[model samples]
Target: MLSRCSMLPSSSDVQSLQGLSGIRHLAESRRFKAWFLDQFGVLHDGKQPYPGAISTLEKLASNGAKMVIISNSSRRASTTMEKMKHLGFDPSLFVGTITSGELTYQYLKRRDDAWFAALGTSCIHMTWSDRGAISLEGLGLKVVENVVEAEFILAHGTEALGQASGSVRPMKLEDLEQILEQCAAKRIPMVVANPDFVTVEARALRIMPGTLASQYEKLGGEVKWMGKPGKIIYEAAMKMADADASDSIAVGDSLHHDIKGANAVGIQSAFITCGIHASELGLDSFAEVADISRVVALASKYSSCPSYVLPAFTW
Candidate 1:
């Protein structure tokens, strides 16, 4: 483990970077080599690719840069790959991809004991609205849409909860309580595939998998979060990359998840400030707009400083 002090660069060190002008030149210089791009904000918002996203990717891909798509998405890797192609990203551009769901399944199935030995005889999965995208049952895991039908339950965020149902969505606090009651009585454990509280949708905020997981815990149900900010996920990412902590770069938007995850492994990071709360940027001299360095300095105070910062993925 890297000592906290060793990972931090003092204010003078940051001042030496020469700011946005230097960043632009560095990006344009074609020296950074490879890119590990995220899906939600950097490339697409659900079904639509953000403007300039395609061209920006094309620019990077054309320059002989190796690209990897790393996401905390609940969708299986194949489904995410299809979405990438649909969003105008050439599938050929990326060499490898990893998702939280894949990691969750692998983590469970490979344990010395059969997965979910603690959860009784059977397990049920409660996935997001994109149900057809993944099938845990193939691995001998049972799948159920409702928690009442489950001996054990696993949940990611619900898309329907954010849309037409709005507050009426089934993952509400009351419904969660009912599920927790059932599980507690039966003594079942819940595994949460993605544990982020909220993710940015362009400028708007939407619920993430962690919200449900945390709620489950409050009800005295055992809940395990399976993604970044959680050690398992970052370790899995490093294993996939076959990378040493000092040789990798983790580019993400959330300070709590992305920045902290990378820092935990001694991997460097590039923070994306456009996501979550941009209003706070103005408080830091519009650091959100000009460059990523300010965000790095700001994170340093909180013990989660990133190695570098970048705007949301734009050319």
Candidate 2:
């Protein structure tokens, strides 16, 4: 694997996790020239930037860090950047933004890959109704009303589907059983743009598009994942930053998404404990530290590991 710790024997389990209180030490070290950051949990909670997130980005920028946002969000990169700006983060802090939606759109437009080449144009587009708007406007794909007419399925979010059906709360997997079964029976292929089961929205866990993708897989339907945990997005991010895997560090809150993605791509990674796994790690408060063994066990559960552990993305 390409990393600073390449001397260590290649193994599934990480040798050790270096603990840190904030990003200041990494900033001072000037180790990684390229930074790949997650959006929802690490930078902001969808409404506002994290306590020290803005300043941390500013500090990294000042230190000549080439930062790129590597988010699993279904919205396009430009849309995600606009949201970051609305959340009080300076848009100039990032060199580029790579999101699942942008990748999905590009694939559909180019029809370059084998999976994308065989697909028909008619699709069932699943996206948010209340927020996080996405569009298939330029892809030449038709959005059909029923599964019978759909040549493929585009899953971006499920929370908004619930909202559209008169429910405002997060949805359970069983809620989509009828629809998924129909698609499965027809052998329809689904493209999941965001591969996160859940995400932090104002400190509350809400169902994401990945959960629906998992359910579809269980029903024997084909699924194409577009975001993190998939190697292509990371490779695209590195290419955009003009960085090599050995010189990049990914900072994110989701283990299965960010950490595992970095691990697959041979890049160093830091895990922020304040995001999705905070409760699982028994963190009573944000300041509550997670025991090393517990952290190791939890990472193992996700079949992933982190190179460094931090309480948050603080300065």
Instruction: Work out the TM-score per prediction.
Output: 0.76, 0.90
At residue 315, give the lDDT of candidate 1: 56
Clash count for each candidate, listed in order shown: 0, 0
Clashing pairs in 1: none
Write the residue-wise lDDT of candidate 2 on 252-309 in tens digits. Answer: 9898999888888999888888888989988865534577677777877787778877
Best by TM-score: 2
Most accurate candidate by lDDT: 2
lDDT of each: 0.60, 0.81
Candidate 1 per-residue lDDT, tens place, 71-183, comes to: 78776678789878877778877767777777676666765555555554345444455433244544555554454656677665544222211122334545555655666
> lDDT value for candidate 1?
0.60
